[model samples]
Target: MFGEYSFNNSQPASAGGHPGPGAGPAPGNLPPQSPGFVGRERELAHLGHLLPDRRLITLTGVGGVGKTRLALRAAAASGPERPDGVWWVELSPLRDPGLLTATVAHTVGLADHSARSLDEELCAWMADKKLLLVLDTCEHLIAACRHLVGELLQSAPDLTVLTTSREPLGSPGEQLVEVRPLPFEGPDSDALALFRRRAVAASPPAAAAFDDPGRATIAAEVCRRLDGIPLALELAGARLRSWTLEQMAQRLGARFDVLADSDDALLPRHRTMRTAIGWSHELCEPVERLLWARLSVFTGDFDVAAARAVCAGGPLPASRVERVLAGLVAKSVVRRTEERGAGIRYRMLDTIREYGHDWLTELGEVRTVADRHAHWYLALAQAADRGWMGPGQVDWYRRMTAEHPQLRTALEQLLKCEPAAAQEMAGALWFFWFACGHVHEGRGFLERSLRSGPRTGTGYTQALWALGLTALLQGDMDAARGLGEECTRSADRLADPERELRAAYLHAVAVMMPGDSVRALTLAGPRARAGHGGRSSGPGWLLCRLATGFALCDLERFEEAAEEARGLREACAELGERWLRAYADYILAMSALGLGHHGEAARHVRAMLSNKRLLGDRFGIALGLDLLAAAVAGLGDGELAARLLGTGHAWWRTVGRPQMGGSPALTALRDEGERRARAAIGDAAYETAFLGGTAAATG
Candidate 1:
């Protein structure tokens, strides 16, 4: 029997963990090395040789060929050579290319303070650094990654980029490295070694059985039939706890032979990987198989509770889902791992998910399962919205962040079959979208759901309001106004005061963008008062108050705005609501600045930035940065203020909108800050400092 070995031995303790003095800012958020990583010695050496000379190296292979694992190993092996340190950015969960730069910037710890674009910031940051960036799982965002890598490599002569994907990124200097499966032949092959290791670890009693020559040959045969793909072999090896080595081999042969007979266009190894998954699927108990099929609807990892809520029904009862899910995990059909503060989550590899999805389609349960998945997430969104202002605020934010991928999948599915359900789900997700800074993705979902068809009643009205709010935040004033008007008409038709209030809130925001502070305040006051009735604390009511506060700030009623914002901030704090609290702080900061309370203004601005960062709210962060720049300008730190302004500018570009739609008050503040900065630092020095700040923030 082969004993378990540690793969982390080849690198120093600080290699991927932390940075020493000379290593620039420890590798930014690299994926943890796999404990079971095995058999990529040649690939590691190949990458080491290629990466030093080539600017871009893409590891290309079919799914489950261990491209990501091999890439990580190669990166860790070469960690000591790069003084600026290596960075890893995983793109598996990203659905929109528009957010590509922002995602990478956030991953690399870029504060994005400049008014310039995220890409510019990235280029400026990388321009003079000696670094290695490993972009894992780039197949989905290949075009975006290609363009970004092209730009960065062009600007930063010393920067090296490595990517893992099913295909090449096709950049100008990209060297493609095809990652093949582990060798299956020969007695000392890596495939057999990996199988024996995993099999023994999975079932300690099976170690003695593998010591027999005949059983060892059976295990090798099992690995060969599974195409020697690391993922497939691991799944096969996990079954050793239940089946004898020979039985597992026989079962795999029978199932794979059928699959191999078809799909000749697919590479032999690709077919083998698929068949290996199908074999595992075939060996599952009926309930486990059903659960596997239903679980395919989820786009990311999910807990047992989510599994039960979305997958349990009819033949698969909620009471039995946990046991079946555990069985699936035991069989290696589902990967189980713990998320900090989020507990254990189960996920299927994309290949396994595709196989299960096909089975789900064949079973004629796609619609049923999709609807169930949508309904489950819809309920979750409602719960999150309800709890957005209470003790569970942080938990709600975490849950929404973790479940965002699934929520998007649900919205996509719902838009096709049930537009009303889609509308409701999108509308319900308003708090998560706005508070968490998922503005781009949320807008996409809202637009798609709205385009699916006309909807009626509360769901449609709320969807209109939500869409209007998103547009307003993104600085699409015309669209916001149109949507707001539509929402108002719908609210009137339905005669719903809550809907009316929400509609007015959005409308007032659109109205305020052009600098009509008094009208905006008047427009929102009555509706907000009506909605609150002195006791309402839902997301809608909070939003209404937020609009009123904004209007007051814009009216230059400094004392009045501070009073309103302070009350709202305190209320939000009591309820543990960070989103509305952030807005309240923003208003308070502006009010403090208006009152020449520079220290208080700085305090409020810092508070706003903290909350925005916590929620991953880049748009809010940009706003906070701008306000902080104003505070610094008031404090006589001209150079720092100029840099902060540039940083804020960079983030604003990422938001895809103008700040406050070029309102008079905001423009004046920006102009005044620049004037003071230039006077204090001189124009040439100010420009240099500003550009540097932009680079640092975006970089």
Candidate 2:
């Protein structure tokens, strides 16, 4: 979901590349390949043969049997054949099936701007593209995967899906490719090659000893004892740096024997895999084991700050976590990698994470660690909220987006044990949810927390205010009004002017959205005045001013609206906040258009568009495009205006909203722009231009 789009004649540098106009560099979403990929030539060749004929291929095997690696290799090898390239969607971080469609849509670069369902948008986007979509780690969400894959293959004839799971997806047309463990018997076996490769990298001394036939026999026995599973071999090989091959082999054999006796219920391969991980765990120092258990709380990759905050205290000191983490990485128990623009992040493989989770449960520290993780993320959300109106707004957005999975995990845990904390945390993340087009997910959290939490205090008031705003954006006026009224009552009882002002702003926006300008003005005017009387000067106060400008414009008070908008724009400029300024620009642009200042209106619209683009605010961008098209229409470029309208409509669909609420004037302007453009160009020509614009937006 996060990469640059380019046009390239040669092979793309990235994995998933979608074909663009004129055969530029393709757009793709494949993750980078793992380092030191040893073998799988036969599997790759088999995949190459199957892919051309099969639309859906499932690489099924036990955990750590190299299914994912084989899939990645096959997809990359087949990239040039498919003009749309390959897309990789990692499902390990996903917990809810409801988010599957949206996640896939985002990965494929489909913005949910239209009011259409995510599935509709995805199907439309992929209908003409020839690509491979790799769904990784699907066993946990097999049912969702089956349904989604079935829908996708039915809708897109040219699209191919490659999935890696412990079992088949069970969807129709799914070709099963059962991945077996690398062979340890032959002299030139892949398992031996992988073991030697890892051993030499882990220790130069081990590399020297491997040259001897005696040592080679020991290494072969070690591989055989571990059943030749790539993950097991690598973990075993990591110990060669500290222990002799014979020693590691003896320890692994003992551990596996103990595990086999203890858990005969598990499948043989599963028992082997868990035994290898448990052997690795036993070799770790006490502090290392403790850190591993604590680190299991994270759902995805984490940084040192997260590690220190969540995994420290209780045998693992905060100051020593970094060193212990490095040790774990060296031992192949944890993986360390550098994420683009995010510096270094650490992750444990799914199998390893499960082992750690089991240990954590045995230790009875699940609640304690979960609470710490929630608290840290709550602080992070609050910080991001504070920074949203400053220079770091975009950075904060990206950080919050990257941390979304972990935040969701935290919220789920908190909701059960500490509902009040859930309310506060969910309220704190409102800006991220709103700005990033996570309306459905955000509303769910807010509603659930509000229902379960106590109906008093600042946290509850904040939750109500946040929920009201989320509903307002979702066009649920009844829910918004109910929440707004509740927020008002709670704020008044608690004597919290800030929450009260926010409630007034919400109510005003709710009424203004439906064309009640006079009532909106009355509701917002007092709050705006109160906010400006040194009572509040944060985001809420700015929003109050924005609502006031919208009401004034809706009442046809152009001059007054322009003046208020300009003032708010200046204030936002001083505060280095673009979100509110974009709205202010929209109000100013509308006023200028109404007052017959075409050039001025165009400038304001362009400014709004630039700001929204900078913030990645798709909804704002759509509204700005509509206004810009209106300005273009007024300036006598109806053809271009029609195209822009089409582009704007496309973006609007991605946002799942037809138009921004609280401004009938703006809506009327959009309608007028469309009518004038169509009249000037004729319906046929207008339709052609509009479709062209939609194509351009999609590209």
Candidate 3:
């Protein structure tokens, strides 16, 4: 059932630079703007006029004041002016302000896996781009938002930021556009228009009903009472699903009377919104209300499967969770979005989610539900670990990417409840953290969880290995070596030979990173050949074989390395395993170049690049591109080699390190390729070709 998995980290660009104009696995998560938007002509005009000229525009308003909706509408029209691509980042789901930079970078299509601070990574990512960034719901993270927006503006001259908050971020160059609720006054008022449109949407028959002058008057009165707030109108209109206009008016009038009596301090509009929301909660079927509260466990959009898993128990049966979720969507308590491949996903507006969170707290089920959520995600992480070797690897990558916010949430839950399990989950996601370009964030979780120190278990052993791999990628050789030693001790203490083999593989890579290929060979060879893992040593064995081939090539045993890499690659191909095969291809390519088989080297690098691209392995892609450049230079395409060299460097920047882990042996080869290219083409021709690739920027 494993379908060959692939990710579109970057669209294939021309031969010179990185991925083309189209980038990332997908465009930023800017949901389609709602079609129900009505009566903001004046605001839309002001925004359109100001957006192109202003660097930062803050849409200030109260909850339910339609700031978010207004921002979306404006952003839709503002795109033509800011066309690297307009990206929207929803901040409501983010609980930790520390993640702000990384979150924005991810949304903007930069899956950075570098060792650099995320602040540096994000700005470098945007340094050469022209795009409009919409940051929604900044009220909860005012200070962080202010700092980030200020820095981004300074770093990316062409970047414009649009923010929605109750208060302005007060950045020096920020412009304020207060989004008051739609005007409630005349019959033709924006509020009345919004109310009518939504009323018709809830019950199509309401369109005909509103044709009656008396009913139209009733609608206006309802809109006037709700004080022109779009959320209040939409909630009131949803009542048309079961009630007529007159009945909606009657129920809402009495509800507001009770809400008014209950609170004298609220603004009329703010009070109207609270009354409408409270009244909607009261109107829900018991199960639907329960589902609403429980689903608050999700930090972002979730699918039916997630809903059933986390929200089902006691009064809520697993079988009924989907039905109740549908009811919530129908009642406008939840929003649903369907995109190709992503499936139908649901999320609540920030205001609604907060209300549910408060109710979840009151029910004393918060911890219980949080535990269930953590367990569900833990199971998914384990499944990902098992499935990454198969065709389903691509899907798992996308699924985990979509669930990242929830994954972070689950990590927090597990850390509080059980540190060991948290560490295991972090380690289990090695493919995601390493192969999928989330290494920076993955390192954070691994380091945090490892603070509990070494544990003697398979999961903990792998976690240590995973951390070592990340350290190596970030060019932190000392940390990587330390982690490798720690992994070896833990595995030996546990009496797990396969685990020991795995540790050996890590130690080998760490040792080789700085050009000590001989030491790497010495460390990994004994464990690999001792037959410690036997039939079960498939993974650890493959890793050691891959490391051995790498060391052999570094040692210039060209013919031996080629034979070893070729045999291992064919074996992996037969088993449908691509990760090790990709590295094997790298080894064969390097060996071919060393043995003076330039065309053979090019073919091997091409095979390696194919696999790396499929898995979205940016680091692998970087390595492959560099070798490909060397091969191309040998094959007499000096200009192309120059371009490839520049493009490979761009990809390496995204990895936060130079290619080949900065090993002296590898760097020598890289230098040779550049030298050949400059010699073959004039220095002037090579520089021009290289600059063309660099100017295209990192994907």
Candidate 4:
């Protein structure tokens, strides 16, 4: 009824659709304003008054009291003051406190691939920005939320943190805003209006039933008995699909009276919300109830396929999931949203999800459901990995990014029981971690799986390769080499040639880390061609070719390297693979630079930067930006080169690395290019341009 701009009487959409904050992604996933915000005028104004001056404001309230909706709307309302934009980081689905900061980082588009602690990275990233970060549903992660919020406020002078929790986070300087339930009768806002709106939309045929003056009193009674909690009101509205307006009101009144008698321990409003939800659950069909319980295992949002895979079993077959899911949507138990690349996804409010989780625990199928959820995500990872070299490449990238939270959940879930399966999934997510800029998190999963799982097996060997890839990217040469060697030993012991070739390919990368391109070429060239029997395709094949091409360029065989890189680029093009294509562009750019084709070098370098940007690969951007600085410097654009160098410096700081991870050769080359730019532009002019670049980055 509120339409696209109204409040979601269903599930909130603050997860992926929120864009990056101004500091990261603009207006970062502050759930779409699809459902027009309803009747929070007083609370919104209060938030608006406090936002500009308060660094930390915690919206404390009972579940289902409209804290998240109010927080998002208020943040949106104060747009001019928050030039860096508002970032919504939903913490409701997280059970592990350890992942709190990482979740915040990921949600805000800080895909940091450094070894540094996430809190530190976040503080630095937000250090000079003016943005409002909304941490929704923090009751479960209160302590962690306090610590992180404190750290961020201390480090970022201009950052404002607005958190939603049942209790205050106890952080100093926090302003507590208790979001009360909507009023059923008021001049400014009335919960009865909300109920009537939703109820009318629920059953359009009997829509006038709610608006009839004779039934207005009964509708008001329904809103009052439900405590006017937005969630409860919406659930009541959905019941109109099955009952007349008067019947729904009478049922709610009876339900609340019984709930009040039974649960005096719960706050009155809490009891009302709980009783309303329980009544909804009781009214569901047995199969629908089961589906709701099983769906609690997912975090954020899930698609129809994912829901079926994780929730379907015994009595709930896959074929029936779609119909049951639609029923849930109709009931406002699950809200559907269209994600950019991922299709229609359904999400439950944290309050509703908690209710389902309680039922799941009651069903005594938590472990079973969790394992099924993990397996489903494992299969997703494997499929994405297999499709990495095909037309689905772009789709897989968006899909994996959309599903990253679930992948993390699966890795953690399996790590406690099936560590080998965990290793396999972590290894299978190579493209996500390696190319999609999750190298740091991939390292964590890979290292933990390796430590916990068996020392021998194909999955274990693949995990080694994946870990090696992360280590190399992180500039941990020793660990990369050790893992590569361990992979080789495991492959030899297992007699798996595919694993052996993968090990060789990674080992060649390790050899190249120390500026030994000659040895890298020697180790990778033959094995690379021989890898998977020289079929010369796929990630392994592409990686091997990429390595050889890099080694040739490092060896200053520019002509030969360019030829090889051209062929590799064409293959990546055919495969719709951007990650390796970016690298191929890198090789081409290097060759062009070496041959003094400055214009060609600039073109290739810019292409590489654009590709990395699409992948959200900040680490790759740091690398690519430096190359662009050089290409422009060689192209005789002194001022632009200086500015590029300064901008690249900020990115280098972000990744905690400088010019090819501190390699002396690359560092010296960068220095020479900087020197040339400085000489060409007068000292004063260069200094001004450089600062302008740094300002742009830091700003």
Which candidate leads in lDDT? Answer: 3
Poorly placed runs, candidate 4 (over 4 Å)? 1-27, 186-189, 205-207, 527-534, 695-699
Q: For model 4, where is the 10-residue window of minimal lDDT?
A: 1-10
Instruction: lDDT winner between 1 and 3, please give it.
Output: 3
Query: Estimated TM-score per prediction?
Result: 0.84, 0.90, 0.92, 0.93
Model 4: per-residue Cα lDDT over 521-559, one tens digit each: 876785546744644665666787788888898889999
Give the alpha carbon lDDT tens digit for every residue of 1-699 in model 1: 000100111112221122111122244446578788888888888887898899899999989999988988888877777766778877776666877876666455443433345688778767877888888888888899999999999999999999999988888868999999999997778998888888887898888777888778888788777778988898888889898887887877787766656756877878778767877887789999999998988876888888998888889889999999999989888989876646778898878887899989999999988888888888888777667778776667667766767787777778888887888889888876665555555677888877785767888787788777767766678888889888889988987767777777888888887777677777677455674353456555666677788788777788988887887888888887787798899999999998899989988988887776555566676677777877887888887887887777765654544365576777777787788778787999888877866655433
Determine which window of 10 residues in candidate 1 has minimal summed lDDT.
1-10
The clash number for model 4 is 15
Cα error of candidate 1 at position 575, Å: 2.2
- Write down the lDDT of every candidate, Cα atoms only: 0.76, 0.79, 0.80, 0.79
Prediction 4 TM-score vs. true: 0.93
**lDDT of each residue in 1-699, candidate 3, tens digit only:** 001111233522111112322243233445677888887899999999988899999999878889998999998787766657678888888888888987787566565655667887788778877788999999999999999998899899899999999889989988999898889887688888888888788889988777888788988889888888898888888888889888888988897777666746977766777777888999999898899899888998888999999999898999999888988887889989874445678999888887888889999999999999999999999998888766676567667777878899999898888798899899989877887777777888888888873466777888898899888777788999999999999888887777788788889989887888889988776445475564332667777778888889888998988887877787787667787789999999999999999999998888887877756677787788789889989988898888888877776666656764566876887899999999999899999988765544332
lDDT of 1: 0.76
**What is the Cα-based lDDT of residue 421 in candidate 1?**
84
Off by over 4 Å in 1: 1-29, 52-56, 75-174, 185-187, 209-218, 244-266, 526-538, 637-643, 646-650, 653-661, 674-699
- Alpha carbon lDDT at 13, candidate 1: 24
Q: How would you encode candidate 2's per-residue C-alpha lDDT over 232-317 as one tens digit per residue? A: 99998888889888787777777766666583788778878877888889889999999999899998888899999999997788
Model 3, which residues run further than 4 Å from truth?
A: 1-29, 526-531, 697-699
